[model samples]
Target: MLALGIEGSANKIGVGIVRLDGSILANPRHTYITPPGQGFLPRETAIHHQQHILPIVQAALKEAGVTPDQIDCLCYTRGPGMGAPLQAGAVVVRILSLLWKKPIVAVNHCVAHIEMGRVVTGAVDPVVLYVSGGNTQVIAYSEGKYRIFGETIDIAVGNCLDRFARVLKISNDPSPGYNIEQIAKKGNKFIELPYVVKGMDVSFSGILSFIEAVAVQQLETNEFTDADLCFSLQETVFAMLVEITERAMAHCDKKDVLVVGGVGCNIRLQDMMRIMCSERGGNLYATDDRYCVDNGAMIAYTGLLAFANGVTTPLEEATFTQRFRTDDVHAVWREKKSLPLKENGVVNPGIN
Candidate 1:
């Protein structure tokens, strides 16, 4: 079946078309760029989506060379995002559903990230480390739900980075995180920062506070370059993420670690996790910006999975929420037992 997905969960507005076999026909996106020392506001971002949704959807359909009637289903991110942006996509999705007479499926934003990671990388039953602006979670499947094994008790890792970038007046064009990564490559000095990990949960608010203070002090005294602050922040935060993911791996007895969400696109974080997995005799799976960051492809793919398995969101009950949890939706597609995975010198011998 062919599915068309609309994603405006955050500042980025994207449209994706996908097939049932996990082939992406078209994935296009436009991000709302804020000035330096600024963050995206929901109102402005939603307006951006409203202005661009029509063109984005048209571009996606044209690029895929498929008519609206050819689309088997319409998929959109329902929640766990900014309310206005979700509504922006929802309004368009409702209009498309009415015009084309296609079924609508609501998808969890976080679940979309996980499903995208699984499909793109073929990482079957891998422990998921979902880190983004609004969320940071370590997930494993259990009882028809993606259970949160660990998460941030305070601010999410990406939020911390973005806020810190604002303090340093970094560019948010591509992304604040990407700018930090670029600056970090030039850094040679590493400043000590607070590292907090309690059991499976990690905390970044305290770390951010300390880093912000250090940046302020250095700015006044000219003691360190901005690269030093960026380097220190990335090392400290990525290390905490790796530590928690490792704990989840040990607890679940899984050898594969699949990283998802926007922050998963970070090369430094991937490198840190890769080293940990290599030392522990496991594998680390991650994706590039296209799949890692929020996109319509993942949303479409996940919605198709559910729609084929007898799931639909009627217009009356179609609504969006800002606080939707990953475990809220019951996945009828994923099986309870683990799917076959390639053995990387861990517990599994071969595909059963």
Candidate 2:
């Protein structure tokens, strides 16, 4: 059994192939880089996906050393993203599903990230900290569902960073957040910023507003460097994130922490998480840019799991939405197990 997946929920367009055993054969991706002080538009991103979808698909197939006829199923991210981009990818997915006579599986974007992190990093049922441009949540599995333990109330972490990068007029070459991470390394001072963590959830809009105002003042007075602002933003925001994650871990009684999503690729964030986990006598598991960000391999692997468990999307029922909650999907693929957050970390069945 083979799966071909498409991921174009945001600025990046990715295609990948994976086998039934959770091994990736090929994954190719291209991101749309907007100029400084600008953000990605849905229509433009959709057009970008439409233009490169075929070439990237061909490239992925060739890299995987497989032909189109060898593919048994087609998968695409179904929701929780810009509608235009999802429709663009869906058009391709539907065409391929019809032309190749393969069943299509619509995977939840957030669930795919969790499944991918678990597969690649070998984190067996860890508390997942999913931080992406569109979402920020600390998730855990309980009662056959991935429940949101903590999340952002306003803007996502990555979106905050991206919008802040625009205020700083930084390059969006690879990504605004990535560039901010690099610049933060050069900063030594940490200016105090608003830290808001209500219960288990976080809010980044106030922090963003604070930084934007500081940037305006600094631009006129040259009082604070961009590096300092970047450093301050990362430290404050990541601290809030770590705080919430630790709360979730303590509440769930789980030691292992798995960080997924695009914002998970930040080295500083990983370091902070590692320190926090070590304090709790636990470990932090993360991935590189490949699986951490939106990619086709995650979709392929996740979709394969769903398909094998008798899940499929008919053409008429394959419509995408802008808000697909992770807990909405019934996770019938995983076994019921007891994983106390703080104990010995041994998973036992029949304890749910």
Candidate 3:
């Protein structure tokens, strides 16, 4: 079966086509970039999606070398994202569903990330660390859903990084987080920042505020460079994440760790996680920017999994939500023995 998915939960708008065999036929995306030191608002972001969603969908189909008649299902991100942006994608998806006469699947955004990470990295039954602009969560599968073992008490780690980049007036051309990662490589000095980790949850508001203040005051004095601040921020926040993730792994008795979401692309964060996983005598699973950041392929792939398991969203229920939790969906497709095959370090998710 073939599926096409749309993603517009935030600043990005993407369309992707995937086969039931876990092959990503085509994935095309566009981002609405704002000026340096500015963040994307929901209205403007939604407008961006409205303007580009059609062309992007066409591009995805063209790249995949397929027609709508060949697609078996339509998929889209239903929630856990900005309201306006989510609605924008949802509307287009509904129209396409009608036009193509295909069934619709509404996928949770966070679950899509986890599913994509699992297929791409071939990490079976691993503790997942999901960190992005709007979410920070430590999740494990239990019962019939992805259980949230821990999460952010305040803002997400990526949000903190983005806001910090705004404070330093860094470029958001590609992404603020990516820019921060690049500059952080030049940092040698580590400035102290607030580390707030309460039990399994983390709080980044205090850290962001403290760092923003420090940047405003100390940056002018040349006492600390932007790179140093970026490095320090990365180190502190990542350490907190590592601590929580390790604790969750020990509690759950899991040996593998999978990192997903936009913030998971940070090299420093991955290095930190790798170190922790090594210390625990386990392995770390992570994807590059393609799967790490939000995209349409993940949605399509996860939705296909649900569709194959006799799941479909009725037209009346084909709507968007802003605050859907990860654990709310019943993951009917997962079997206890479902595992991807890996050959020569390449994962074959279709083998399941």
Most accurate candidate by TM-score: 3
Ranking of predictions according to lDDT: 3, 1, 2
Largest lDDT belongs to which candidate? 3
The worst-scoring run of ten residues by lDDT in candidate 1 lies at 343-352
**Model 3 ranges off by over 4 Å:** 336-352
- Native-to-model Cα distance after best TM-score fit, residue 198 in candidate 1, in Å: 1.1
Q: Which residue pairs clash in candidate 3?
A: none
List, in order, the clash count of every candidate structure. Answer: 0, 4, 0
Per-residue C-alpha lDDT of model 1 across residues 79-180, encoded as one tens digit per residue: 899999999999999999999999999999999999888877777888899999889999998889999999999899999999999999999989998899
- TM-score per candidate: 0.95, 0.94, 0.96
lDDT tens per residue, model 3, 1-352: 8899998999999998987667788889999999999999999999999999999999998998899999999999999899999999999988988888889999999999999899887788999999999999999999889999999998999999999999899999899999999999999999988899999999999999899888888856999988999999999999999999999999999988999999998888999999999999999999888888889999998998999888999987999989999999999988634444232335643211
Query: Stretches of candidate 2 above 4 Å error?
Result: 336-352
Candidate 2 at residue 260, lDDT? Answer: 92
Better of 2 and 3 by lDDT: 3
TM-score of candidate 1 against the unseen true structure: 0.95
Q: Residue-wise lDDT of candidate 2 within 44-103, one digit each (tens)?
A: 999999999999999999998899899989999998899999999888999998889999
